[model samples]
Target: MTASAPQVPPRVRVSEASLNVLRSHTDQLTTAVNLHLEGTLPWYRQLTTDERASLRLIAQRGIMGLVNWLDNPQTRSLPLVNELLGSAPTDLMRSISLQRALQLIRTIVEAVEHRLPGLVPVGDQQGMLEAVLRYSREVAFAIADVYARAAESRGAWDSRLEALLVDAVLRGEASEQITSRASAVGWGSTCGVVVVVGPAPEQADAAFMSHLRRQCVRFAADAVVGVQGDRLVLLLGGVTDLDTGLERIMPSFGPGHVVYSRIEGSIDQAHRCAQAAYSGHAAAPAWTLAPNPVPADDLLPERALAGDDTARQMLRDAIFAPLAEAGNGLLETVTAYISAGHSLEGTARELYVHPNTVRYRLRRVTDITGWDPTEPRDAYVLQTALAVGRL
Candidate 1:
């Protein structure tokens, strides 16, 4: 069965109650826009029925938040619109009213037709200046009010929404709706998705975010964008792991060690995939994304650790297997050997052992694992495996 249709909100109730405070502001806006347009508007001017309904639905979504903020002490100052406006906004804006709001619109249109110096005049030229200042202040506050409510809303519901959005996307049905939804949720047009595991920001601090964005850009020059969360899902449509890719980008990200997940498709799709790649249970790689259906191997802490864990079943066979078999400190010796790039002199200096002793242990590793350091390639592979295993 088809899902039930969304409830249609009554304009009267919305304008008078939840949207009451915004009513006067809306009236003011209507007057301002009309004056600029001239007095040719028909009576009963309002958003087209469809636009009205859409705006109302959007407003109601916002109002639910306003109601919650009113109840919250930490967020009490959040709804300034209610204090500035009211629950019973005047009907002056309704076309049937033909009232003060309409009068203001008429006045501005007349002034414009008469070639008034500016858009709207308050009274005398002095009033005009004052009106200009007052109008500007009101408009500025209104913009700030919208953002305040938005930021508050994001804090309360974004995690759930992000998850929902991701599901909708993965289903392959909401591609067109994605951008609009992202904007509604406060993901700015110019943004990035970072996948970090150590910590996620409780609040996206302006300077910290700027630093992150700036650092990412410095490396790629608009090559990357991100959305912050448990995984810093990133969209790297602009950079790749080509010879100069990392060279052209990624210098500013001071080296604690990080990997850029690869993505394919439009920047927007890249944005989504970046989240998916990082969101999955693995550590990202320090290389380019290989292609569609991305690798099944997720970079995880357990897999990246520094030992041969693939055959743990053999452990009890030797009562700790290699651990017991090594007898003293073979793991430590091998670790040092790997870190020193399998150089006998370096491992000896680090371990305070004779270089000959380092060689003997290296030979022993070959005996146990059937992998030998005598071949330089095997040594490199083992070292990388060990590093990830440790991670």
Candidate 2:
């Protein structure tokens, strides 16, 4: 005959009598936990009556979960900790912090352990004590696992909602849905909103966005970002200065010109801002010396040259109309100055005016248009705006 293998008993082997004792005293274990909470935790006293009742139910379930684990026939069967704790209202999580939840768990476990000697037969005391300790550990792990899963689920849903909001802005879809969705993503009217457009970095990981979010928080801003192919777009709010906020976040973009929009009062209006930034970003390469975080309005010359109607109209409004409306011979003087190859003496001699008079008019031009005629960069912008306005 073949020799039989030796049978190994399970780790927990509570006798029928010990199981009966635990079942009969489940109420006692629960009451002990309640008394411990009332005596030890001051915060517990602040909770509403309903909240305290819900917590008591959870404690009761935990004690019964231990009893079920001890009496379970399958040696390797784990306690149904999740089911026992699942009946607790979801609102409890919002009202009670995880630290407080852990405190409650610790108190309940201690109560059960304190009463374990009387609850179990003397011969089975040590095994029962050890089993209770192991079960409590399992309960703690289960609580952590539940909270982790809850947080992961919430994060995933938020990401998808954020993607949809970004897509709507990129597509220029303004509707009631956008307003409701914006609120869901934490956008509000009180904060200044700005849109930033740039090329998405190669091989960027999710952690890159995580770092970007932390940076935004440091600067007292909130951002909703989406990466579409090589394009990355962000709608940022809570910033008093768009330029300063972008300075903190610009390092996360890929190697290319990034464009920022004018700050608006609300994110609801940011789709227009996003459109302008994207337009400028498309025309950004035309200005080789453009700063990394160039303002969308600053790219008007290039954008207008690229046949953007808004850019053309902007040039007409911001540059030509202002000079035309000032009417101190500013428009005629500017035309003559550019035509004179930017020579101060040449412009004065051609216009039959004193050089000081021409210089004074140029200062007036700078004040009206926020552009200096002598600087090469500002001169190019003025010349382009003049050419577009005349057309």
Candidate 3:
């Protein structure tokens, strides 16, 4: 069963006599706040002259907000404080935290309450103290409301900035702007990174992103997730194992093709990795028997078939060039092995060598290209790489 929504706080009413007492001493209350801040808050002394002035202004506006809320007790307190604090410069909100702002409110409330006995009549003093407590509560809620809005605004802006950074990574655009943006989104320059691409879930929204972030935290990883068209791209960092990380995050994506790039040293080289994942994602359907979370390199045959030059060059460099460099008849042995229907004896016969020599050369082939000629899948990739390199 679903839970019920929280009820709103009840509005508090202020007595007419207390309201008059507060209105007459607005300047006194403001001065009291200033003196209390200087004596109690060491950080207040560290603020710039303009920042101090802004704080004083917010405090003064806060007093006026209380008076206004008192005048129209039935009106919402949120609008009352928001309207008052809205006049302060937006930058002030950044300089001050919610806890510090609440401290500021407490000081102002205490300063006002301290002077009540002097300004208010004896009969009205009790009423004045009660009004002060209620007014303080309302002010506290208003301050909380303002900060909540600011937090939401900051979160939205960060999400957009992160999306732009991911876009730059995918498009292979290396610029100072990309670096600056990556830093802004907390992407460490030296962290190991990988890019995962797949179709996005249907209801991709703030809640979904929050869930994805929580998953990252659970796995001790950092990520920037973006939805470009139907594709959801996640740039994961601090991951020591791409395959392990993929296993944990696989449930976050919709079914279809999910491809992860090999771990890269830094985000700067992430674009190269992202390109491979992007190309592989497009070509993944061709590999009907592909694993759920397939490595981008595993799709090299499909990528090469789709005319991706990057994939073609990757195949040539990773497979063909290594064998060619080893020389020692390794290249011919590979060709002959596949041509001999992966028969060790047949390749030995074709190369006019002992069967053991063919076995040793096949082991050397595995060491050179990290692919086993005996495995059907590895043999297919090797055959494709040789064909692509020759073309």
**All models: lDDT?**
0.41, 0.80, 0.82
Better of 1 and 2 by TM-score: 2
lDDT score for residue 105 of model 2: 78
Model 3 off-target regions past 4 Å? 1-20, 89-92, 217-222, 240-244, 263-265
lDDT of 2 by residue, 1-391 (tens): 9999999755787788988888888888888889988888899989999899988888887777777777662323223644655666354476687778778878877777788887788998988888877887777766666666677777667777777888887776766777778888876545477788899988555667666767766655567777777888887777665567778788889999999885545666677688889999999999999988999999988998887888888889999999989998998888888889999999999989999999999999999999999887888888888888888
After best superposition, candidate 1 residue 99: deviation in angstroms?
28
For residues 271-294, what per-residue lDDT tens digits would candidate 3 score against the true structure?
778999999999999989999889
Give the clashing residue pairs of candidate 2, or none. none
What candidate 2 gets wrong by more than 4 Å, as runs, is: 1-10, 71-79, 89-95, 170-176, 188-191, 203-206, 240-244
**Candidate 3 versus the native: TM-score?**
0.87
Best model per lDDT: 3
RMSD of each candidate relative to the true structure: 17.1, 4.6, 3.9
- Residue 200 Cα positional deviation in candidate 2, in Å, after optimal superposition: 1.9
How much lDDT does candidate 1 score? Answer: 0.41
Stretches off by above 4 angstroms in model 1 are 1-35, 38-132, 148-255, 260-391
